[model samples]
Target: MTSDQPAATRLSELLGWRKSPDPGLTWAQVEDRLATEVPRGVKDLSLCFPTGSFGGWIHFYNPVQSERALDMFLGRAKTKTENFKYARSLNHAEFPHRFHPEEGGLVAWGHGDQHTYFWSSQPGPESVLYCDDHGDGWGQYPGSVPEFLHALFMDELETEVLYGQWAGCRFFTEFPDYAG
Candidate 1:
């Protein structure tokens, strides 16, 4: 429950996150595939917990999960395909800004029942942000990916902004197959 401890240890103790056995993919591999650089925080995250779901509600997109979702999300920009209609519907410029994947915009790392977590491409004070899917801004989550998860699991963050619909529930983590 302390920031001084390791992020994985804290997550394991607080939220029951377990690493995947697949050795996971590296940042370089993902970047090479995407043809773009990703934040080191996100890289560390994918290494730590690939294809993890939180509270049986939120699913974080890792290399394996992104294998399909990422392509679909990107494909929408080209063919307006229904394969990822959600991507087509997202408008970052709306009241609550989200990931747009163009012009150096934010990118999604995870999504829950009512919220989606994103990492901003634009350099700023904090690296993480989330929107409630509605037109309201829920502000930002501080620290890098691991740091943010540490704080979040330890209940060190504001509940209103961090969990939304998943608030008050005990967190969970697992590595299920990427069905998407």
Candidate 2:
């Protein structure tokens, strides 16, 4: 056994994964066991770590699939018709809260000192939806829009789906000029 061998062995023991030549046990069997043992729910879901401008973020999806789930979790109507109906009801009822659809999503902005909240049903695959208290305002350090975006993307409550073709994702930070 080599140095790397010990690490692999240790990992296998920790995960109860062993590479035995026995016909009764296969890699696929191990994977199936792991999946079955793990419970499924919105709270248990997770998104891939973000890349590019959005990093260090997490996302989750709703456990149930229904109009109520869409409204409660994503904060958007289940369909365009439902969204229109909701909007119309708000308008006719003269409800204090106003609703609108933007970028193929439902949005509500006017609230007491609260940042505008936008929800899109068609977020790109791997993209998750979330609300940030900071709003779109950009500031230096953790208060910046980029940081907030990162936070929302990384939120544990966001749902993820594989959307859109991947071209490439990249991010870069510039350094201040230094003259000696």
Candidate 3:
């Protein structure tokens, strides 16, 4: 439910993730390039996991690791903005979001099959949010980024928005390789 440990520590102990050997990306670099303030936990995550799959399901983009990945995420977010606006136009009651990049909304951090994870950039209590591809399945996640992940690894965070992408899968650190 909550984590008293540091975000990186919890992530390492639980996921056995290793930080990249290269110099980690700095806040200045991110700000200069992305022009968006990434969450602290997310920054910490890059120090360790950088770019990797979580539980063999979700792929986290490490902005500092590659410009292409960062550009891809930005592009996706931009596209989502237009798409969500169109969805809202269809029916404000059903699709009532302007994406995060619009009016100080949540910033997307990662995504899995049919699900995208976001962090609230607004004031007040911090929390996470996710929306499925259908635009109908949406929900909030409690805790900081690390805590949310801990809950997810422990099978405490519940929702069908992921469309069972993580079903029957235990948390693993890198890409799953069978052929190699």
Q: What's the true lDDT of residue 133 in model 2?
A: 29
- Candidate 2 TM-score versus the reference: 0.20
Lowest lDDT 10-residue stretch of candidate 1: 76-85
Those runs of model 1 whose alpha carbons end farther than 4 Å from true positions after fitting are 64-93, 96-100, 124-126, 159-168, 178-180
For residues 1-180, could you state the per-residue lDDT of candidate 2 as single tens digits? 233433323322332333321122232342242221111111112111111111111221121222232233233222323544464575544222222333344332111122233332233322222322232231111221222233333341222322122212122111112100
Angstrom error at residue 33, model 2: 34
Please state the error at residue 100 of candidate 3 in Å.
3.3
Instruction: Please identify which of the two predictions, 1 or 2, would achieve the higher TM-score against the true structure.
Output: 1
Give all TM-scores, in the order shown: 0.68, 0.20, 0.79
Clashing pairs in 2: 57-154, 58-154, 60-158, 60-159, 61-159, 125-162, 125-163
Return the clash pairs for model 3, or none. Answer: none
Among these predictions, the greatest TM-score belongs to: 3
* lDDT by residue for model 3 (1-180), tens: 126767666756776554452424556876566555677777766666655678866767666665555665576666666766787798787666556656666677777776777877676566778888568778888766766776676677778665443335545454322111
**Which pairs clash (backbone N, Cα, C closer than 3 Å) in model 1?**
none
Candidate 2 has its poorest 10 consecutive residues by lDDT at 47-56
lDDT of all predictions: 0.57, 0.26, 0.65
